[model samples]
Target chain A: MTTDDQIIRNIISGEQHAFRVLVNEYEDLVFTMCYRILAHRHLAEEAAQDVFVKVYRKLHLFDQRSSLKTWIYRIAYRTAIDHQRKKRVRTIELEKAPMVADSQDDAQVLMERSDEQQRIRRGLAQLKTIDATLINLYYMEGQSMEEISEITKLSKSNVKVRLHRARHKLAEILSRKQMEAT
Target chain B: MKNWESDIWRYLASELMGTELESFEQALKDDPILADKYESAQRLKRNLKDFPRLSPNEGFANRVMQKLPAGLNRNLWVQKLNRKPAWYFLGGAVLLVVVTLSIGWPQGSAASSDMDWTQIWQWSTQLPLSFVCLISAVFVLLLIDRVVTR
Candidate 1:
């Protein structure tokens, strides 16, 4: 129930439980972003955990120039990209990328598990890491372009240009698949 | 399909406005292909938006929390340095003055060759005890910086 500033202040004051609250608060956002970018559960988990550790290490340097969410997302995006590069996987490979975890309610999950795993993940895999991350930030996370630019270190114009390219690429890939099926 | 590159994107992202928005809207109604592409693009965005989110398994928070505390206590001096840099800055300035003053023996004089250990000892004896303490403090500061930065 504590405000983010109060949580940050408590953490800077060396309260261990305050950090726990922070980790809990942002774990899902960090983990989901990592998983989508890397398309590997284990790597995403490691990256997410590393992000929190880094946040703790660098907490004292948080100068309050940006909101806590923006700062943390920057760290998360940077860490995920670092791990993704070190793994040398580049972008997520649809062939190897795991299907979204199994769920009875998820028809897409069911479809992905069965015959057409490549339908969407393939298009996403073709995207550059920055481009895929742009889609995730915009559509999935609902971040504004300004925030996306801050997180990705791209200029606003660059974000707009790249996001448009990414969307077009996805449409082309999906439409090509449909044409092939017909 | 091809023409939807920039305008359709801006329209669906709700970024297009004023004249540009009206023109795109008119085009959407006038052109079947453009309208179809817009619908498909919207579907693409909706699907991406609804992409499944992955949550950390139970106790993920505890695992990360457990790893943080050990490193937190490792750099005690850095914590102090971050908290109060002014004191350290002032201390460093005083140390510089003391070291400079203490080492300020008249040098390269006409009698430089004749200066001996006895003369050096005499020069040292003339310096205040506080100068010697300041040199020791400088050494301690260097050691702390090494440890903290390591």
Candidate 2:
């Protein structure tokens, strides 16, 4: 396995093909993180691509103070947030913006596979971006509060408090959805 | 339902420490309702953990690789220049002093032990042209880098 430092050095030294190793390694992680925040497959894909482009441009500034993955996660989080903000602005301009249709069938198929998972996703989608991201970082990725704090630039206490509230909110949403279904 | 909901999440996260963890465990054993809530929270956690990770559509990596700008290597040089400009300036200054000293004072001006205004004027005139040439050379190199990378 080529180490991250080696891959970085190779890319910096003008071997662009070496970048494929990096893209391959982090694509799923970056895509999943983006998807969790954006909640649309096509938008998430676009955001993930944006993240890689930013990473490539800024790779020279990576000082190695933090692990490569954490740095990339921070970039991914910020990029997705930026995309979400731009998306919100565009929706406002359009007024009565169309629903994101690309991912609906994929989401429906996945929901059919597991009702509870879909319920959780619905609950997550309703939460604030920060809260949902915290939940994804905590439960889905199993990141510790400290790691989440570093990635999100929130204080440790803030990550804990938000995560606690996020879980309760998710539970409330899930119970309400269940009641509706019954 | 109660404030213990926060405690349940903390405990699930394994963030509750020492006495806090102990107390939560004790409460879990004592209160049937709390125990039931804990069970459900645990189930929710399991579902979240098991949630499938979504991959981007096929050839996602290829798409990303294709979209990567070809100018990154040239940008890296620009970034390096932006990061440590002092070194380049110092090198230029040293080169300027060496070139000036190597030209040696005009032989007649030095022998006469006089300030030769005409000699000084000629040297000063040549200095600006040399500086301009140096800057143009740098600009041309940058232009070449940009074109080649593109």
Candidate 3:
């Protein structure tokens, strides 16, 4: 298992295959970010490809000051946002949850996961992309505030404040949605 | 005590440490509302994780890799040109146009009324339109290449 720094060094030092390792590692993460932002699988896939290509071009520009995950995430987020703007697709309310883990999980767990996903998707749909993204990164991805601040290019204080507000808003939206559903 | 919201968030985010964390834990044990908020946040966090895990299609990495220029393979001229932006191609096109106009304008301007129809025909053929056409064709090819490649 090569360290991220080693992989980065190898890529920069003219080992082209080193980049494939990076793509394999962060590809799902980039795709998820793009999917959450774009809400379209086709567009998200396209955005993910663009993000990887951009990462290759900018690999030489990356200083080792930050973690490669943070750098790639920032690229993913920015790329997704750019695609969302260009397409201007209307955010649709999620009607049914796809059970990606249905085969692996017991029925009860799958049910909870499906319900939870639906509620979260609804909450996200109600919020702006950045707000939803902040909550997604902090909670879903388990990113620290400092790491998220770097990815967002926001001050630590600002990231913390905004994250709280976003969560609170999401909670409110979820509560409202449950009320209506009930 | 100053900003309990920060404390509550830090506690939920697992960012609280030592004394601050100890005090918050005590508060959570004592206050029902605070504990309820904590419970709500925990539920939210767990549910958030279930939002979705979207992975690209199977051949996604290969497609992206194919699109990526052979960065380390600098020996490949196509890779070298592929790395340049569409703006560079556009600039090359504009430069070609300038050179063509500069060469064509002088000779075309000199062909006046004294030149017969056949002379006019000769002058038109004398202009470097073929070279200009070739350059323009290459420019269009580059533009199409950039759009398609991206």
Candidate 4:
């Protein structure tokens, strides 16, 4: 497999296809990050495109000190946050969770899962952009505090404290949502 | 009670270990409020852990590649533009307006009166040579800036 370093070298050497490789690797993660912040799939897709475009332009400045994943993540986070800040006045619309159906049982389970996903998405939409992002980096992506710190530029302790706070806030929102649903 | 939230989150995350873990679990069994908090945190953790993965539509990478060339060209143009001061463009625009007025005012005046071509030529020639040269220089510089940036 071509390593990340190799991919970067190839891209810097004018191998445009290498960028596709990089984008393919991180596209879902970047899209998910954007979706978490923007709370709309269409906006998330646009933001993801912007993130890749930016990464392509700024690839030369990567420096290789941090992992490529973290670097792309930082770019995705910042771009999504910028979109959110600019469009704060716009109402958020949740994208319907996609369903896969191979069997009746599978369809049933997927429907339940989709409902849960929608609930989580709604809860996240209620949060401030930074808080939602912190929760996403911590739980959804399963990033280490140190890695989250690197991606977010927050201190490790700050990441920890803020992540905990965000977790509590998300729990509060989810519980409130559940309370209302019943 | 004040620290119960973090404690419950820590427990849910398995960040609490050994004695801390034991004590929190004990508190969970003893205090109904702490138990309730733990239950909620555990549920949230489970939901977040199982957070549905979102994917972009197919050919996402291909679309990105298609966008790359145009994006690169635009970025290069912007970076080149940024290297020069805005005042250069502003000066060019101001000079262009002045040149248009200088040339247009005489034509306008001539058309309004019985003044013929010679009178207009004389008026033009009577204008300061230095001002004309300055306008030419500004126009040429603006053209050169545009070419170099392009």
Cα lDDT, all candidates = 0.72, 0.73, 0.72, 0.71
Where does model 1 exceed 4 Å of error? A95-118, B1-27, B30-34, B71-79, B83-150
Model number with the top TM-score: 1
Q: What is the TM-score of each candidate against the true structure?
A: 0.70, 0.67, 0.63, 0.62
Point to the candidate with the largest DockQ. Answer: 1
Number of colliding residue pairs in each model: 0, 0, 0, 0
Candidate 2 DockQ vs. native: 0.27
DockQ of each: 0.28, 0.27, 0.23, 0.21
TM-score rank order: 1, 2, 3, 4
Give the CA lDDT, 0 to 100, for residue B90 in model 2: 50
Candidate 1 scores a chain A TM-score of 0.85
Best by lDDT: 2
Clashing pairs in 3: none
Q: Candidate 2 chain A: worst 10 consecutive residues by lDDT?
A: A89-98
User: What would the per-residue lDDT of candidate 1 be over residues A123-167, giving only the tens digit for each residue?
Assistant: 777778888788888887888888998889999999988987787
- Residue pairs clashing, model 2: none
What's the i-RMS of each model?
4.4, 5.0, 6.3, 5.7
Model 4 lDDT per residue over B1-150, tens place: 237545656654333222367677677678787677667567666777778667876788888888775543444444445424545765775676577556655555566778778866766663556467566767766775564334
Chain B TM-score against the true chain B, candidate 4: 0.34
Among the candidates, what TM-score does chain A have in each?
A: 0.85, 0.85, 0.86, 0.83
Q: Once model 2 is optimally superposed onto the true structure by TM-score, how far is the C-alpha of residue B90 displaced, in angstroms? A: 10
For DockQ, candidate 2 versus 3, the one ahead is 2
